[model samples]
Target: MFRLALKSLLNRRGTVLLTVFTIALSTALLVGVERVRSEARSSFASTLSGTDLIVGARAGTVQLLLYSVFRLGEPTANVSWATYQQIAAAPAVAWTVPISLGDSHRGYRVLGTTGAYFEHYRFGNRQPLAFAHGEPFAGVYEAVLGSEVAAKLGYSLGDDIVIAHGIGRVSFSNHDDKPFRIAGILAPTGTPVDRTVHVPLAAIEAIHLDWQSGTRLPGRGISAEQALTHDLTPRSITAFLVGLKSRVATFQLQRQINEYRGEALSAILPGVALQQLWSLTGVAENALRLVAACVVIVGILGMSTALLTTLNERRREMAILRSVGARPRTILGLLCLEAMSLTLAGIVLGVLLLYAILAAVRGYAASQFGLFLGLGLPTAAELYALAAIFSAGLVAGMVPAWLGYRRSLSDGLAVRT
Candidate 1:
C-alpha cells in the first residue's frame, strides 16, 4: 500500500512538487521568525550583563537606559562630578565606571571613560571586553577603537584621528588641534560597544579646556600639550555604571539614588529596564509571527485545494482499486498518507533551507546590523510548532480522504447505467 501511494503521488509530480514548495516556504518563515525573536532577546539581554545599576541624572527610566546603554539619545542633564564621587563612595558600591559622551569621530560615538570601564564592564555571561590588538589607552591623547569602528574607519594602532566638537557627523567645528593616536582595537562584542570609540575621561576635559558653556572661548585656544598640563577634572558626566557589593543592596541602593538630595538623580536595574523596553516594543515581534502564521495557513490551504481537485480526476483510479479488493478504508488511508508525507517533507526541507540561508548571511547580518545568529537544532517550542503543522496537514487531508471513501463505495455499487 505504501508503494502504491508513493507511485500515485509520483504520477502527479507537478502538482505535488508545487505543494511541497509552498509548504516549505511557509515552514521556513515560521521557524525563521521564532529564531529571530529568541536571538534578539538574548543579544539585548547579554549586552549589559553583570551590571547592578545604571545611574544618571533624573529622567525617565527608559530614557536613561536608551542613552546610557544603547547610546541612542542625548542626556537632558549631566550628574555633577561631586554627585558621582558620593555615589562611588557608598559602602554598598563595589566599583563605578563613569562615562562622558557628546563627542564624535566621523559618525561613530566617542566615549570618555576611565580604564575601569575595561576592567568592570561585561557582556554575554560576564565576558569582559577583550582587545583585538594592543592595550587600553595609557595617556590622555590615546584612543581605542571598537571592532566595527576600526573596520569601517580603516583605523590601525598609532594612527592619529581628530574628534569633532559635536556629536553629529556634520559638525561645523573640529578639534583639529588635539588629535588622538589609536592605542588599541577591541574584539567584537556584538553590542553597541562595537560601534564606539573609547578614550580616557581626561581626554574629554582636555579637548574642552578653551571652551565654556558649549563654545570655545575667543583667543583662549590651548594646545593639547598645554591642556594636559592643567588639572583635567571632569565637572560632570553623562552617566555611570555601578556594581554593588552584594545583590541584596541593589534595590536599597536604587532607592537611595532615586531619593538623593545632592542632585536630582535616577538609578535603574539594567535587567528590569531591559524588560520594560522589550515590553514596549514587543508588538513588532508579535506582528512578524502573525504574518508568518498567515503564510503557513495559505500554504496548507493550497495543499488541500490541490488534493481536493485531484480527487475528481482520480475517481477512475479509485474504482480500479476497489475492484482489486481494496477496502474503502484503504482508499481513505492512502489519501491521508500522501498528505502527511508532503507535510513532513516540507518541514524537513524548510529546516534545511533556513539553516542554509542563515549560514550564507550570518557574517553580513552581524557586521551590518550587529545581529549574531547561531545555527543549532530547533528549540522545544519550535519542535512543537512543527508537530502542530504536521497535525494540521493530516486534518487538511481528511476532506479528500472522505471523498475518496465515498467514491469507492459508489464504484462498488454502480450499475451499467
Candidate 2:
C-alpha cells in the first residue's frame, strides 16, 4: 500500500516537489530562528560566568550592564575611587576589578582596568582569557587589543595607535602625543571582550590630564611623559566586578553596597540582571517565534491546497483502485500518509540545510559579532516543534482525505469523463 502511494505521489512529481520545497523553507526558517535565539542567549549568559556581582553608580541595572559589560552606552555617573576602594576592602569581597571607561581608540571602546582583570575575568564556563600572541599590558603607555580589534585594524604587537578624545570614530581631537604600543592580543572569547581595547587604568587618566572639563586646555599641553610623572591615580571609575568570599555573602554584600552612605551606588547580581533584561526583551523574541509559526502553518495549508486541487485529476485512478477492491478507507489513508511523508521529508531537509548554513558561517559570526553557534543536535524544544509541524501536516491532510473518501464511495467503479 505504501509503495502504491509513493508511486501515485511520484506521478505528480512537479506539484509534490514544489510543495516539498515550500514546506522545507518554512521548516528551515522556524528551526533556524529557535537555534539562533538559543545560541544568542547562551553566548550572552556566558559573558560574565564567574563574576558574583557588578557594582556601579546608581542607575538602572540594565543600563549599568549595557555600559559595563556590553559597551553599549556611557555610564550615567561614576563610582568614586574612594567608593571603589571601600567596596574592595569589604570583608565579604574576595576580589574586585575596577573599570574606567569614556575613552576610545578608533571606534572600539577603551577599557581601563588593572592586570587583575585578565586574572579574574571569565566567560563561557569560567574560561579565562588566553593570549593569542603576547602577554597583558605591563607598561603605562601599552594596550592590549581584543581579537576583533586586532583582526579588524590589522594591528600587531609593538604597533603604535593613538587614542581618540571621545568614543566617536571620527574625532577631531586625537591624543596624538600619547601613542600606545600594542602589548598583547587576546584570543577570541566569543563575547564583548572580543570587541574591547584594554589598557592600564593609568592610561585612561594620562590621556585626560591636558584636558579640563571635557575639553583640551588652551596652550597647556601635557605630553605622555609629563602626564605619567604626575599621580595618575583615577579619582573615579565607571564600575567594578566583585567576587565574594562565599556564595552566602552575595546578598549581604549587595545590600551593603546599595545602602552605603559614602556614595550613591548599586550592586547587582549579574545572573538576576541578565534574566530581567531577557524578560524585558521577551516580547520581541516571542514575536519572532510567532512569525515563524505562521510560516509553518502557511506551508501546511499549501500542502492541503495542492492535494485538494489534484483530487479531481486522480478521480479515474481512484475508480480503477476501487475496481481492484481497494477500500474507500484505504484511499483516505493513502492521502493522509502522503501528506505526513511530505512533511517529514521537508523537516529532514530543513534541518540539514540549517546546520549546513550554520557550519559555514559559525566562525565568521563568532569573529565579527561574537555570536557562537554550536553545531550540536537540536534541543528538546526544537524536536518538539518539529513534531508539532509533523502533526499539523497530518491534521491538514484530513480535509483532502475526507474528500477523497467521499468521492471514492460515490463514484465506485464508474468511469468519469
Candidate 2 TM-score to native = 0.95
lDDT of 2 by residue, 82-192 (tens): 889978998988999999888787788889999999999999889999999999999999999999999999999999998887788778878898999999999988889
Off by over 4 Å in 1: 169-172, 211-219, 409-417
C-alpha-based local distance difference test score of model 1 = 0.90
Specify the poorest-scoring 10-residue window by lDDT in model 2: 408-417
Highest lDDT, which number? Answer: 1
What's the distance in Å from true for residue 253, model 1?
A: 1.3
Model 1 lDDT tens row, 233-261: 99999999999999999999999999999
Alpha-carbon local distance difference test for all models: 0.90, 0.90
Model 2 CA deviation exceeding 4 Å by range? 360-364, 409-417
Q: What is the lDDT of residue 94 in candidate 1?
A: 97
As a whole number from 0 to 100, the lDDT of residue 311 in candidate 2 is 88
TM-score per prediction, in order, is 0.93, 0.95
